[model samples]
Target: MKVSVLVITYNHSRFIAQAIESVLMQKVNFEYEIVVGEDCSTDDTRKILIDYQQKYADKIRLLLPEKNLGMHRNFVNTLQACCGEYVAILEGDDYWIAEDKLQKQVDFLDKNLEFTICFHNVIIFHEDNQYQPYLFLHNQPPVSYIEDLLIRNFISTPSVMYRAGLVDNIPNWFYEQGMGDWIFHILNAQYGKIGYIDKVMSAYRIHAEGVWSSKNRDWQLNKTIKMLDTVKSNLDGQYEEIIDRAIQFYSQHLLKLNSIHQGTTSKFTTNLPKHLELKDINFIVFPDWNQEEEHLYQNLYCLVRLLLTHPENNRIALFIDTTKISEEDANLCISSILSNLISEEQLEKNKNINVFLVGKLDQIQWRTLTSFLKARIVLDSENSDALLTSGTEIIPAYTVNQLIEFGLIFIGSAKPYKLNIGCGNVRFDGWINIDIEQNYKTVDLVCDARQKLPFDDNSCELIYNEHFLEHLTLKEGLFFLKECYRILKPEGILRIAMPSLEYVVQKYMSDDWRNQEWLKYPEYQFIKTRAEMLNISMRWWGHQWLYDTEELYRRLTESGYINIQEFAWGKSNTPELRNRETRVDSILICESQVLK
Candidate 1:
C-alpha cells in the first residue's frame, strides 16, 4: 500500500462509521489501506469496525486487542501494523470531508521528497454546544522545522500525514506522553522538514468523553507541563529557556486561580501613594470649553493625583497644547506616542487593563481615540470618586482627541485591510474581525454589520460574511449589502456565504430526504412534512431572511456591484478565498466586485 490511514478507537460507536466511511471514500490513484485498532471497545464501535473490515476485507486490517490498551498503546500497535510508505492518522471521532484529501497530501510528499510530513487544516466542532465550528490550523505557517515543533504543536491529529518507518520502535516515553500527536510530530520533524496545506478538508469532534475535552485551566496546565518535560528531554538545551518560561507561565496560573476564587481584591487598595501632579498641564482644550469645563480643568491637576490610590486605575492624562497643533497633526503625534508605548503584542497580553483617555476631547477626536487606543474617555471631575477608588493617573498630553484619531489612521493604514463582518469566533488571519459580541481577543471591533460599517468609504480591499446575511431582515440585509459596497474599494472583492433557499427546498422535496442523516439535525427533528421542514429551515437559527442564487445576485446588483459570479462549495475564482471551509449542498457562495 502507498498510504496507510490509522484510526484508533475505544468507545466511539456513534462516530466510528462516519470516520470509516470517510476513509473509504478517498479518491486516489495510488493504493491505500485502513488500519483500525478497536482496543476492545465497550460500545458498538467494535461491531461497526468489524462490519467495515468484513465488507472491505482486502483494504482494511483490523487489530482487536483482547483488553483495553489505552490510547497510546493502541496508537503505537496500530501504527506498527501499517505497511504503507506514508501513514495518515485520524482518531475515530474525526472524519475527513474532501475526497481528494489523501491524494493532495500524497502528491505533495511524492514531489517534495525532502519533506517527511504534511498537514492541512481541520474544523473543530463542539458536539454538545452551540459554539460555531472553526478551523484549527488556520493561522499556522506553511512550513515548520524541529525548532518550531519545540515551541508549540501546530499539528492536529486528523490533519497530519507523515512518512512511515521513521520510528523503528516506539519509545517507552511515547506511552507516557500527555498528547501523543505532539510527540509524534516532533519525532517526524527530526527527520525532515514539515509541510502544511491551507485547505480545511477534515473535522475534529470535541465531546465530553474525549480526553482533552472539557478540561479545566489547572488540568490544561498540567498537560502543558508534561508535554514541555517530554520535549525538554529530546532537545539538548536548545529550547531550555522557553521551556523554563513556559513552566513559569503555567506556575503563575495558580495566582490567577486564587484571585478568581477570592473576591476582587486590589493589590494597591490600602495605603497607596498619590498620583503624580501635572504642573504645566492645567486646562483642558477642546473645540468648545464652557465655564463648566473651565471649572473641571482648573481642579484637574489635584483631582487626578488624589485618584491614583486604587490598583484598577490605568488612566493616563495627556497635556498637549492644542493651540499650536492642528487636530489632524495632533492625532498623528498621539498615535505615534501610544504606538511606541503599547505594541499590539502588549495589548493582547494585557487585555483586562483599560487605558483611560483622560484629557481634552474633541467631538470627532474622542471617537477616534476610542477606536484606535481602545481607551475609555474619562473626565477627572466626572469620575472623581471612581478614579480615587480605581487609582487613575494624570499624564500630560498636548491634544487628546485629534492625537487619538491620528494614531488610529496610522495603525489602520499599516495593516492589510481585510474585514470579516459578524465574525463569531471564526477569525481569519490578518483580518480586522468585527462582531456584534466582544471577546476582546478574537474580535477587533464590536459593531452591528446591519448599521453603517465602522470604516471609511472605499477603505477595505476584501470583505467576507459567512451565514450572517440571513440573520438580517430583507430591508436590513439590503442596507447591509449597500454598506458593504460603500466600504469596499473600487476593485474590492466581497464574498457572501449563506444558506441557499433553493438547495433546502430541493433537498426537502427529494424522495431520499428522510433517509438523509443531516435531516436528523435538531432543527428539523420535530418537523414531519417536506413543507414544514423547509419552513423551519428558513426560519430557525435566528434567520430573518433566506435567499436563493437569483435573489442573492439581484441584491448584489441593486447594491451597485458588478461582475457577480456564482461559486460552488470550496470553489472560488479569487485566490486565497477557496481555502475556506464551506457548508456544501446547504450553502451558496457568491462573489461580487466593485468595478467602478
Candidate 2:
C-alpha cells in the first residue's frame, strides 16, 4: 500500500461516521486504506464501524478488540498494524475539510527526501461552540527542527503524515505518559527535518469528550511538565536546557494556580471584575464600599462566626457573589478563615456545623438559596435578633420534646437518650446510630467516634456496640471506652461485643473443628492451613486488636466502669440493650455500669 490512514476511536459514536467518510473521500492517485482501531466502545461506535466495513470492504479495515484497551495501547497496536510506506494520522472525533488533504501531504513527503514528517495548519473547531473556530497555527515556516518542536507541540495530529518506519524504536518511556501524539511527533522529527504545508486541511474538534481538551487548565499544565521531565531523562540530556526552561515555565504557572486556589495572596481581589457581595451578613468590620484585603478577611471571619454560633437545626444561608471567584477558592477561603478565627474546641462543640459553597447563582441556585433563608425565617420569626447569639438559655423541658419532633431544635434532649456506636448496618430503634463510614443508610451521625463523641457530659442512658471494638487498636479502644464513660450518666449501661481471642486460639488448636460451619464462611473458606485461619481471624476485616474476656474486663475497669459483667449472646439485663448482637458464634459479650 502507498499510504495508510490511522484512526483510533473509543466511545465516539456520534462523529466516527463523518471521520470515516472524510477518509473515503480523499482523492489520491496511489492506494490508501483506512485502518481503524475500535477499542471496545460502550456506545454504537462499534456497530457503526462494522456497517461501514461491510459496505467498503476493499478500502476500509477495522481492528475491533474484544475488550477496551486504553488510548495509549490502542494507538501503539494500531500504528504497528499499518502496512503502508507512509502513514497519516486522524482521530475519530476529527475530520478532513479538504478532500485532497492526504494527497497534499503524500506529495510533499514523496518529493522531499530530507523531510521525514510533513504537516499543515488545520482549523481548531469548537464542537460546543463555546469559542469561535480559528486556525491551529499562524506564520508557519517552511521547515522546523527538533529543537523548535521541543519547546512546544505545534503539530496537530490530524494534519500530519510521516514515514512509517521512522518511529520503529519507540522509547520505553513513551508508554508511561498519559498522552501520545506530542511525543510521537518528537520521535518522528528526530530522524529528519519537519516539513510544513501552509493549508487548512482538517478540523480539529474540541468538545467535552475530546481527550486533551476536556481536562482543566491545571491538569493540562501538570501533565505537560511530567511529559517534559520524562523526555529530558530519556533523551540523554541532549535538550536539557530547552526542556528545563519549559519545565520552569509550567511550574511557575502551576504555583500561581495553587496560590489562587488556596487564597494565599491578596492580589486575587484585583483580578475580580466586581466587588464580591456577602449578602445579608452582619458584623462587617469595614464599610461595604471598601474592597480592600482587610474587608475580605473581616467578612470571612464573620461568616465563619455566624455558621458556628447558629443552632444545629437552623439552616443559615450566606450567599456570596462568586462571579469572579471559583467555588473551590470560596471553600478554601472559608476553611482558612475558620482555622484562623475559631478555636479547635469551638469547632469540636459545633460538630454538625455545615457551610455549603455554591458557584455563580442561576435560577435553580437562587431558588435553593431562598428556600434555605425562608426555612430559617420560619424557625426564628418570633425572635429574629436571637439568632447567632451564644449562651442563650435552653428552652423549657416541656417544649423541647415537641420542638425536636419538628426537627427545629437540638439542645440535647430533656430525657437521656441511647447510643448505638459503630452501628454498621445493624441499627436499633430509638437509638442514635453513629458510624464513621456513611455508606449505610442506618447511620444517623457520621463522625469518627475516635475523636470526642458529639454528646454532652452525663447525657447518655445506654451505649451498645457489636463486632466493632476489634477494629480499633488497644489504645483507641481504651480511649473510646473512656469517652463513653464520660458521656454516660450515673448508673448508665455500656455494652460491647467483639471477637474473642480465646475462641480463635481454641478453634485453631482443635483439628476437628476445621470443617465447622463458621469455617465455611466466604472470608474464611480460602484458608488452607490452621495458621492462615488464625491470621484471617486476627488480621482480616481491619482488625487491629482482639481481646479475651479478662483483657476486655480489665480495659473497662481501667476506663472507670463498675459492675463489669460477662453475658451470653443475645443476653442483656437492660431491655433496650437485649438481643442486639448480630454475630452469635466465636464472640465475647460484656456489660458495665458507670458510677459517678
Best by lDDT: 2
* lDDT value, residue 498 of candidate 1: 83
Model 2 stretches with alpha carbons more than 4 Å out:
263-596
lDDT of 2: 0.71
Model 1: per-residue Cα lDDT over 1-25, one tens digit each: 8999999998899999999998999
RMSD for each of the candidates: 14.4, 21.3
Q: Over the full model, what C-alpha lDDT does candidate 1 score relative to the true structure?
A: 0.67
Segments in model 1 whose C-alpha atoms lie over 4 Å from true places: 216-218, 242-596
lDDT of 2 by residue, 1-596 (tens): 99999999999999999999989998989999999999999999999999999999998889988888889889988999999999999999998878898889888888998998999988785675433356779898999999888877889999999999977767778888867999999888889999999988888888899889889766887798889889888888899867765664454345344433555333323332242322222111111212454656664565456445555424333333334455676667777776764574355544544455434443323322232221221110112222212101111111223323322223223447688888877776557777775422365555688889877788788999887788788889999999999999999999998879998899889986485556653323346898887876776557788999989999999999999999898888888877888775537999999999
Clashing pairs in 2: none
